[model samples]
Target: MTEMTLDPRQLGTGGLFTAAVPDLASHEAAYGRRPSGWTRSPLLRELEASGLAGRGGAGFPAWRKLAAVGAGRPAVIANGAEGEPLSRKDTALLRQAPHLVLDGLVTAGEAVGASELFLYATAESLPGVGQALAERRDGPRVTLVEAPAAFISGEASAVVNALETGTALPRDKAARIARSGYQGRPTLLHNVETLAHLALVARYGAQWFRSAGTADDPGTRLYSLSGDVPAEWVVEAPGGASLRDVLRLGGAEPSSLAAVLVGGFHGAWVPAEAFDLPLTARGLARYGASPGAGVLLALARGRCGLQASAGIVRYLAESSARQCGPCMFGLPAMATVLERIAAGERAPWLASEAERLAGLVTGRGACHHPDGSARFVRSSLGVFKDEVRAHLAGACTAHHGRV
Candidate 1:
């Protein structure tokens, strides 16, 4: 496993050690509080005022989501089904700070007038989270559900489908799960970490929460910082911190990094020269990237970018749910182009084929698969222009294995 370094200044109070399970009695004594003062605190409003964004990939405003679900008979979902292969932040939170996550679920349920809470995780994640839920006596009104471990199956709609009918498959776009989820009720689905933040906001108040992050996007975010560092660890830092700061905090050598993949496979690629960029959604947008799912992969210079991208493309292609024509057909075609490019093949029609497939897939699928696949291939071509050129030139003989 590659080592990753995290900067201390960018980290939250407990930093990397925050996820370590503390003594239950001590944790309860310090964190456990009866559900009271709900109306007085105006927790949801305060969270909106504080500008707390979701720690999940999309960085959606937490308050906005709460307001969307408002005080009604809504359903709250803790999305622990982290489908990204390279990311483990959610799993770590579920395993270590399960109580905190549950607290957030309960708080969100209260704020949104949601009486029912559901905790959904991949089948592999069920045991740990289930045990954690069993240990808690007075938290949210939640039920644990185990979803299929397929990559796309962990998506929100897929989770909802699994919860409703025990089928871990994504529904058609026309039938968005949020509009009619879990027994036909309005639902507010959030990542487990997002709910945990809500619990903290409810307990500490939003001003304190806002004190750490940026002016626009407040509160901390958990990132699975991997590759080219001293330690591969999960780090929590305030939103909008400099990527440079995060790299340094993760003990990564600033100069050696060739590029950073800001989001997971679905995110854009940014060259190392852009490290000075802030880690907020707005900051990343300037670079045509978003920290989707908070995965930062550092690539070394000698590594072939085409090879790295080809591996991810293959993974995405294989992970396709095969529910739609575009995603089912287009991803494999894109994967073939990437593999050929990585292998130093200059098929005259490769570029155009990729573009055609990208066009065919974009926005045609029920999920973001088409868009994410397109972005992955498009960013690879743009960021790895030199590599694509080299492959066309037949210059590099070494093929770096999958990333």
Candidate 2:
């Protein structure tokens, strides 16, 4: 697998994982005491009231995913396999606030009738998890499974396949893993941060969880803010906070940016006009933006958006699992056209042809890889409309050179 080099830094003042060395006793003190007994059904109802959503990019409702856990021995897998190149909040949380994440894992495991809790993490994150696990004298049955660092390796299906089949590729089957996962039993999986919030929700109840952000997208979330910033920061803000506010928290001046990629590579592109929208799932949906994996990347002033996009597309092409024809063929084709357009090629069919290629591969692959790639391409086209026109007119606003 190819190694992606990116900054994995964090803010020292945030609520979670900002500590240099957070201990278990301090975690318990900050979040209040833990529960001795937990019932799955009641906890599910509480989660429904909390309006909590998954932090694993998709933002699916947490209560609903827990409800899908099948009858047999269930499992809770904490996904610390944060594979998005521009994201590093999970890594920071695992290293800094491990006990809180562990509280979440143990709490969630009991809520789902899970026989054991699985901690799936990239190899780089193991030492901290190991340190925390070693500190724990007693807890639920917890096991750590190290995963190879790759973009798709953190995906739910891929994580399952890695454990069951020893391959990090996503399963070709169409069924949801919540019903049949991890030893052919029901599984309750959550991103590392989301599970931490569950520990909060279990103690404070849903109303307390809903008190911070909007009613639709309640609670606070962590955002890995990078690209063109003086320093990278992992911020914890309310769910519906404006992108403008989040950017400021990340030490970015909104006026200085050409555009910002609200999500990671597989997410949307929003120009400054869309910056006013809230960073919530429902709010960003108004502008077709997904705060996927809570990544906020701003383009450097005068940096070529087209060139940057083409480079990202090429990375997506290189990272494909090659299971389906569309992912294997369509992505590389899209990247080629994108690189050409970024080079100030005066081809009229380039924009339309890029869209056509994206459509052919979208929603046609076994995993969401093709669909995500298409979203990235479609949003880039709209966000860089003026840039696209300039390229077609044989002029370059940023630079004509290749990425």
TM-score, predicted candidate 2 vs. hidden true structure: 0.93
Q: How many clashes does each candidate structure show, in the order listed? A: 12, 0
TM-score of each: 0.90, 0.93
lDDT of 2 by residue, 295-333 (tens): 888887688888889999999999889999888899999
Predicted model with the maximum lDDT? 2
**lDDT (Cα) of model 1:** 0.74
lDDT of 1 by residue, 1-403 (tens): 2322242322222332453454446446656663555641387678777777776666788877766653347788989888887787777777656777777787777766786999987666667667766666656557888756667766777888888898877877666445577677778889888887777777777787787777866777777888666677677766788888777776678788788888888887888878888876678775568776788888877777778888999999999888898767889989988888788775656766777788888989887777888988888888887777768666653344222
Highest TM-score: give the candidate number.
2
